[model samples]
Target chain A: MLQIKDLKATIEGKEILKGISLEVKEGEIHAIMGPNGSGKSTLAAVLAGREFAKITHGSVKYMGKDLLEMSPEERSKEGIFLGFQYPIEIPGVSMVNFMKTAINEHRKHRGEDPISASDFLKIMREKKALVEIDSALTSRSVNEGFSGGEKKRNEIFQMAMLEPKLSILDETDSGLDIDALRVVANGVNKLKRDDSATIVITHYQRLLDYIVPDVVHVLFDGKIVKTAGKELAIELEEKGYDWIKKEVDSE
Target chain B: MENDQDKIISDATSGEYKYGFYTDIEIETIPKGLSEDVVRLISSKKNEPEWMLEYRLKAFRKWQKMKMPEWAHLKIPEINYQDIIFYAAPKQKPHLESLDEVDPELIETFNKLGIPLNEQKIFTGVAVDAVMDSVSVKTTFKETLADRGIIFCSFSEAVQEHPDLIKKYMGKVVPSTDNYFAALNSAVFSDGSFCYIPKGVRCPMELSTYFRINAANTGQFERTLIIADEESYVSYLEGCTAPQRDENQLHAAIVEIIAEKRAEVKYSTVQNWYPGDKNGVGGIYNFVTKRGICKGEYSKISWTQVETGSAITWKYPSCILKGDNSVGEFYSVAVTNNYQQADTGSKMIHIGKNTKSTIISKGISAGKSQNSYRGLVKVHKNASHARNFSQCDSLLLGDRCGAHTFPYIEVNNQTGIVEHEATTSKIGEDQIFYCNQRGISTENAIGLIVNGYAKEVFNKLPMEFAVEAQKLLEISLEGSVG
Candidate 1:
């Protein structure tokens, strides 16, 4: 469902993601673990079509289409959703209206009629319960004056609303308490399906316990130095990234 | 006619305006130039009554003796009145009897502006009277509005059909000699709307007038007067847009409102005229005089405006609190982008005991534009216990933009309490990045931040206009952020 070949990304003329190649089939969960500034979030931003990132040379194909050729909004409508590490606050723009617009914009891009307001509300209520997202958060402007936990949960809540095929969670658990992390991980676990895939980007191994990934990759510098099973996250947690760096250096 | 400051100011509005499109529409325009004979010709064309002609003559004489105001914080070249035409209407356009008689190009302009007048039911609770150039293309909801003892029609017809009402309130708030442009507007005003709400009636909808300037080198002089009688309430809205012109055009307008005892009047304006190109060579110079008077005890008047257009805007819609316990309020959100310059705010005069006034203004400057907020609040000795609260906030989108606030507060009453506060801030990169990290696009983020900053003023506009204004705020600052 996704293919990135030699993904070389730079921001402000400085190279960040250097020669990254990855492929994930449908129904698989892939986790990328790295220390701070290991280009973990940069990968997510590049995949989400952020304009500030410079794609010096690379080919990213989503569903066999040239992803780099599309705009951020176009990529979003094409079922590519990135759960922002820090959600935006849009004061005066209620969450309901924002979701409704996103939903309808995606629907319009598919040449479909807008969902009725009543029907839209029904899905929103149902998804709100599934994600454990507070009703108050849903009523307020998108993430305006929200807590860190609420912002992360709101991203998951929107993921449920849009139902994107490829969901990239960027540091969803960075600032979450254990309880909040459980709720966020639970939401992601519930959304996983046989036809959809999830790419979890995180620094800690704790979040991996809740949303167990089928594959774990270590991102050192700009490239993934090693790909392992779920046990690899535990190994790194016990030994720390410095131990792995020495082992990779010797190898 | 050129200097460093003038060049800097003119550089703000240099570029083609979004609405400046050339359409192949037939028009009936008079020759260029201004004179007493032209004023007489306009009055004769309207077939005005003898008294109105006399009034026009009086205003023309006042205009002749008055000198142009140069004190405003603007950089506009001298206007050669003789080089501009005074009157123009569409060819084959008689008194509009039906919507079909309206010019298709004018309707197209409104359609592009997202203000289609044919809609029967929509937000903003009312009908719209679309005035393109010098004529009203169509006035909607006439039957419904007329049923409520309301008189809504062109100023020309009002002079003929409701002369008694026109005579009673015309120039009652802003007299012909109030300012230089006002005298000019009164002298050769072509056409505008006049509305009257009788005693104890509340207007059921939001009344709107859209002015579209299409003809070249023809100044737009319009006169609008609305009166709410005793125990009545009414809200009136006006907006305008013009085609691009390399030669600067003049728009001098006068608006007066009167509220009787226990009556309320709310006036809102969303002025978006063609503000000359990025270099400010040919945009409209909006010199308007608008004032309202609360004549009876407990009367109230409120003015709200979103001025985002015009090359050099010089307007100060004001209020006179003459009635005991009367209230006055002014809320404004003015924006200057590119070569635009606006020195606008309002003045409030308190003369009656216990009169209260409130002023809230937000100014936003983007690109190389300059925006200023000039306001005055005065309380007379007789206005015991008079209270006023003023808050002004200015937002600078880019570092090159300029924002200035000039407030004059005068109090002669020992019991009056007055307070003023102002702030200036930039759309900091941190705030934007914080929003972007949450997946919201930069454009939507700017809109959200601006709406939050201008919420106090946006709340002053009617609900529908507020929504439209919010979207317009987003559209106006599209490239300003990125």
Candidate 2:
């Protein structure tokens, strides 16, 4: 469902992603293991259509269409969700209002009538239950005073609400506690469909324990240097990025 | 991202003024000049009493000797008094017995403004006094109000019908000599609404005056007076709109209100006069003086305004708490887009013991506009146990715009308690992108953030006025971001 070839990206004249290539099919999950400054989040941001990351060379195809051609909002309407590492805090915009505006815009794009208020409330309740998030969060301003873990869970709740075909989770498991992590993982697993795909970008193998990956890739210095099965994540977690750096530099 | 955000904000300022259409009705206009003779002629044209004519003549002489005040943070262009037409009214019968006798074109104009003169067609439960240019076209629900001893009519009618009340309270709150604009308005003011609720009575419906400036090369000077007697309560609304013009049209108005013992008065304004073109070539110079007084113990007065138009808006609706234990409140949301500039706020003067007041002002500036909040809170020596709280917040949408606050507080009594808070915030890039990533457009994102910022002040407006104010905010900032 997605393809990337020789993706070289830069920000502020600094190369962050160099000659990267990857592919993922439907019904599959890919775990990208990378150390700090290894361009994992950069890739996610580029795929999510962030404008600051200039693609010096490469093309990304999603659902057989040029993904780079669409704006961020258009990409969202096209069923691509990016779980931000740091969810933005928008004061005075309640979660209900934000979600309703977003859902109506998506409906408008799909040639459907806007959702009724009662239907929207019902859907919001269902999504909140599915994500195992507090109902109180939806009544407050969007992420204004939410804790780090709550913000991440709110992002997942939003992912559940939108029901995107492709979701790129960028460090969503970083600040979560064990119980919160379990709930987040269960939310992702529960929302999984045979026609959809997920890309989990994380540092360790802990998250992969819950959401098993179909394939594992090790990235170093803006390039993925190794690929294997789930065992690769365990090996990396045991030895860390030192071995990956040694192998890549020796090449 | 910064460049894209700038493009979006600049795009927002290109929204066309929606109420900038001129009617094609025949109009009668006087010569362009300010003189004793001109003032006398206006009073004579209205068939005013001798005393009313003398009032106008006295104001004219005062205006000639008073120079325009330049204390505001505004770059006002010099206005030549002799270059403006003081009076312009639609040519029609002097008096109308029903909506059928009104000119069809005039009716169409009011209808276009969503203010129906025919009472049967209105569902908003508002008693309207529709004023076009220099005269009141019609006032609805007059007899219903009269049944409860409520006096609701045009200012000219009040002078002729209820002269005692007019003589007692016309300039008690805001005198003609209060300011440069007030003097000019008092000298040549053509027409506005006058409302009075008798002692112990409650006004059945909202009293409103919709002012439309339809004639070319003319200034609209309307004087509104409202009085609530002992134990009475009334809510009055005022709305203004003007046709588009290449040269600036002046809109100088005066509003005075009084609340007697245990009485209450709620005054609201939604001023959407035509702001100039994108280049700031032309628009209304809105200089207005509005004030109120709590005249008896336990009385209350509240002023709520949503000002979204006019090229230059210099207004401060204030209140004087004269009775012991009286209350005063002011809530305002002023928006400046394109080349508009607004300097507005409120003033609270505590003169009696145990008085209280609260002020909330929100200003939003977009494009290359300038918005300022200037307010004052004063507790007199005799105002023991006086309490006051004031909050002013400013939001800026673009780097080119500006937001400023100037708050003054003075307390003479040691027992007085006052608190003031002020803040300035920008429409952050991250906030906009967060909404955009959620499938909303940049324009809608700006609208959401702006409305959220002004929600506090908007909550004080009545239900219908609040809805219109929100829509006006959206339309004023539409397509700012692409």
lDDT tens readout by residue for model 1, A155-209: 9999999898899999999999999999999999999999899999999999999
Model 2 residue runs over 4 Å out of place are none
Q: What is candidate 2's lDDT per residue for B224-328, written digit by digit as tens?
A: 999999999999999989888999999999999999999999999999999998899889999999999999999999999999999999999999999999999
As for candidate 2, its clashing pairs are B8-B480, B8-B481, B11-B480, B12-B480
Strongest candidate by TM-score: 2
iRMSD per model?
7.0, 0.9
TM-score of chain A of 2: 0.99
- C-alpha lDDT (0 to 100) for residue B226 of candidate 2: 96
TM-score of 1: 0.84
How does model 2 do on interface RMSD, in angstroms?
0.9
Q: Where's the lowest-lDDT run of ten residues in candidate 1 chain A?
A: A86-95
lDDT of 2 at B146: 97
